[model samples]
Target chain A: MNLLLSSFSSLTNKVLMALAGLFLVTFLGVHLGINLLLLNNDGGRAFTAAASFMGTNSIIKVFEIVLFAGFLLHIILGMMVSGQNKAARPSTYVVSNHSATAPFSKYMFHTGIIVFLFLLLHFFDFYFIKIGLVAPPDGIASHDFYSRTLLLFSTPWYSLLYIVCFVALGIHLNHAIQSAFQTLGLNHSKYMDAVKVIGSVYSLLITVGFSIVPLFILFYRH
Target chain B: MNFTLKIWRQKNAVAKGEMVTYAVSEISPDSSFFEMLDALNQQLITSGGDPVAFDHDCREGICGTCSLYINGRPHGPLKGVTTCQLHMRSFKDGDTIHIEPWRAKAFPIIRDLIVDRSALDKIIQAGGYVSVHTGGVPDANTIPVPHEKAESAMDAAACIGCGACVAACSNAAAMLFVGAKVSHLALLPQGKVEAAKRVQKMVACMDELGFGNCSNTYACEAECPKGISVVNIARMNRQFLAANLLSEREKVVNISL
Candidate 1:
């Protein structure tokens, strides 16, 4: 493993980072699908049943470990790559112009940092409770993510922060999906434009899909 | 036209650099950017001052010898043309232009607005070549290259090895330059013989040269005087990944043996 890592070039590092990030992208889709069950109007029964299955399933336990590893690799590689990139230019131009590229491309690291902070909050809210780290709110079962999610979203401030983080995640994904395709060399001239469009649409869907739950809970559930 | 120029001035590679402002007047708008610089240099010589040192060879823009970061844009504000081809008409009278050297760890500044671009040549020396027997030149259409392949190869071949891509990239990455070099040759039959080895060696060299990783900003493509597309970068990525995978698999086989 050490020999393999030592032999990997900068391009290889980027490829690995892109692969990890794409995995996380797919994971977000699964997470959103499960979370959408919160709105089944069945008083948390459907959502809790699905959440309980995910928590207790043996396969999902293995997948959870893989998911953590993916996040760790993505974050570590992202920081290393960005640090080296910064060091590559010892000096900066007095007048810098980046008008030629997408405005959000240069800010991926910034948005990544924001999303990371939000992840800490999210894990504290839910993952910690699942593992008996933090006690579930009064009278709610430790495994009952459904009531916990609604309880948290019912707070106006918490819902607002959740929506804000989703926006940041959306911005990050707007560049990340297409960038991963480019990094992986899957981009072709004939289809690159289409890939870019798909990336935008996918990001928009994730942002809106996740934000709707909080908005629906705060407005309708209350 | 008259203008104020804030040009970086460095005596040598080890010397500290600073932006020194100068004024030039009564310049024709039709004069090339180099002509304007020449006028300024002439004035400096007559006034007992050191003339600014800038690189230039062919005034027609093909020779990639000239490099300047003018008013924050590589090769001046014009697209698809080198500094030698940029005219003074692009700027208005009394405009204040900022001129600086290409800033990259790989391409260190040699003097004011001039950097040592031998790093690019080193990458080329790594593998950007095709091995053919020394004999009479082959017939033109012997390989029977597809029209699309030839056209795309030509597009990639248009890169002039100017470090503008490095200058324009926020990370100062040379992926575009290396990608163009790799793509032009890799697309042709003659180059396919060593495509795997070529990409591996060049990429290794690029990484060792302190260049940054590409983040897909496409700034290099936008600032490239030849209008080289980032698609060449994608091609290089594909080539590098495939080459590395094959070589790694070979390593596993060798270990088993």
Candidate 2:
């Protein structure tokens, strides 16, 4: 409707971006749950089975489309919002602003860019193989994600990059979960502390949970 | 206390500004920050130099007129106080203090440390009011308000519109100022009459004024002289969402009709 379109402003853009980000957050949890199956001690039999199910499921296929859409929308709107925010101050201050805000809050865009670059590397290692854009390494099937993940994490530099990216992802999500709630108008004084606590906990879980897999592969799996 | 001041100096709104250094000696630690500046101005006038221009009124914190980004902090190093109330005692002797105006596209420099904050006034003019008819004063307690709601409304009403929030924000956003105003009214029964329309119009005006979006950095809450909470911003966002999505509108008639 014209009335609806007329009301779409910066706030609306933020709300949409927050919704997309929250969607990606949920996807991260689901992905981590699936990835943790790599530690099943059955030589990745369980992990590969689950990865195949996720790759072939009809509903998940549709969700894959939505997931990519969410990522693109979140990235595009984030760029737009950051651009406008940068333009709001035409000149730099002689002295740096020293407000006692959370240190990571201002660097959301920076952390987000790091996470995005990591996502590209991750897709090249895994998703691109699944979609056949990149060929799987010799003797590994395209559906054998567990082997591919183990192969990637087995390299010291690759594991280091994975851990570093997970750290950046953690920092990004630390502010992001609560920020998304605030942007969506779901925040309140009564529960805002709880939201912040939950955000920190979730970010920690994702960072530790994912990083543990790489360490486990590199150290114990060998 | 002897101190060197690195103050922003500009001839007028259109002129380029720079950090102009000056030395002030024998300032009493008991003197307020503005008084120390007054002494510097006196010395400058005697020497036939232009006095640094800054905004101040009421000498106390209530007027919300005084503004300065001293040492990278709005209203100097103290928390929950304005520049007018900040004393020279907060700084050490021989310290060089940096002072500048609020930096934002919506707030242009008027002189040296004085910025034109009329963009805030424009936001207020958009819908930051109730459309009450002029009449005899209504009796108290005529429309009952819950105690908690009234308390919350008063807390939000403490915003001084000093533009410190805008200065403190990385994005130069005015959400805190506008949020405080919107929440201050939206919580009360008198303001409830036009709450939906008020939020919509005010937000439209804010976006058009070239102020940035709130990224939830919370620097506004930290640097606000009144210690206005970011909860008010959340309340504003809630009001804005409800207004745009749920508020029913009257049917529009064609001009010919």
Candidate 3:
């Protein structure tokens, strides 16, 4: 534990966050693919089946637990890192003639707060509602995932909110992916171009794809 | 153009500091930020008031001497630009600009807007030098470096020991600055002789100086006047990790075997 604390305590939060973020990135790919099912004219069992499979699989259950821990750890470490940073430089620049120092996503403890709030509402409206814990108001088909998403997506304001959060996710991912590689020491110029390209593409897709659902649902009733 | 300035004035290290407001009238927009400060100083001199003492030299932006916390940013609003490079045009007709020095516990205020950045010097003293001591100037081409590596090394070497990286950094971490220094020397063949020990000493010095950890923020890169890459930070980390693992293993082998 002393060895662990000595070496890992300082950067442990960042390491955990990078790993968890990568996990969520993979999860995003799968989740988005499943959500894309709702785009179908003849909405098949793909959405429900994928959801059901993810819901029941023992391995997935374990993964979910890790995922939850990852999210919490990420937040906890992020907060710690941010707090230390704040204490390190107690005074802000007076007439800051300088450009931004940290990447927007890099210095985003405050932005993460916004994202965390959005995630809470998202989990409650979708996951919690489906899991039977959330006692949705009468007349709302909270359990029907498709109907639930459609309902939220149908409203312009709700769709706008999703768009806003998705934009934040883009901001978050743009910084995190490259940073994760940096933390892991994969920042050589030889492969850095490829990493940067992949990071940008991945961030763009998550930002554009996630927001598209709400826009599509809002414009075209399904 | 007339401008109002809110400058941070600290009497000494022990004294608490605050922003003191001063207005400058009839200023040319073409004047550099420091030049403008000089003009303000001239005005103060005429009025028998204390001149605002800030650190600056080689006003050409190479020496990295000018340290000012200009309006909530390190060098002022221009991205990838330095205070010396900053012109009055960036300001409006009547702008209320706040100016302060780099604030950190290690960088205690010496006077108004000037703190002792010798902590940086000490870190450099610890390991920035090569183990190979020079007797005299040798044939330059003897230590051959690839054009790309040489250029990159020079670019990293461009770090003027400016605490801008620390000032710009929200974490106030000297990773980019230190990384640039470490990489500048580490990348070259001449400095490679001491590479194993160089990293360990520099990192130790950095920690001893009371700077924060990097936290993977690239703000230092963005704000670096020399455009030092945050990738240098990664290079530094890899070097440190390698030194710790391989050299320490060799040490344990000697003890046990």
Give the best candidate by DockQ: 2
Q: Share of real contacts kept by model 3? A: 0.53
Candidate 3 local lDDT, B1-257, one digit each (tens):
99999988888877878889999988899999988999999999999998998998888888888878787777788876678889999999899988888877568789999989999999889999976575576776776789888988998998987788888776788888889989999888888878868877888787767777776767788777888888888888778767866765444445554
Model 1 Cα lDDT, one tens digit per residue, A3-113: 454356899889999999999999999989988988889998878888888889999999999999999889888888898899999988888864399648998999899
| Count of backbone clashes, every candidate in sequence | 0, 0, 17
Q: Which stretches of model 1 miss by more than 4 angstroms?
A: A1-7, B247-257
* Candidate with more favorable, higher TM-score: 1 or 2: 2
Q: What is the TM-score of chain B in candidate 1?
A: 0.94
Candidate 2, what DockQ?
0.79
Instruction: Please estimate how well model 2 matches the true structure, expressed as its whole-model Cα lDDT.
Output: 0.92
Residue B50 deviation, candidate 2, in Å?
A: 1.1
Q: Model 2 compared with the native: what TM-score? A: 0.96
Give residue B256's lDDT in candidate 1 (0 to 100). 55
- Candidates in order have lDDT scores of 0.91, 0.92, 0.78
Candidate 2, residue B95: Cα displacement in angstroms equals: 1.1
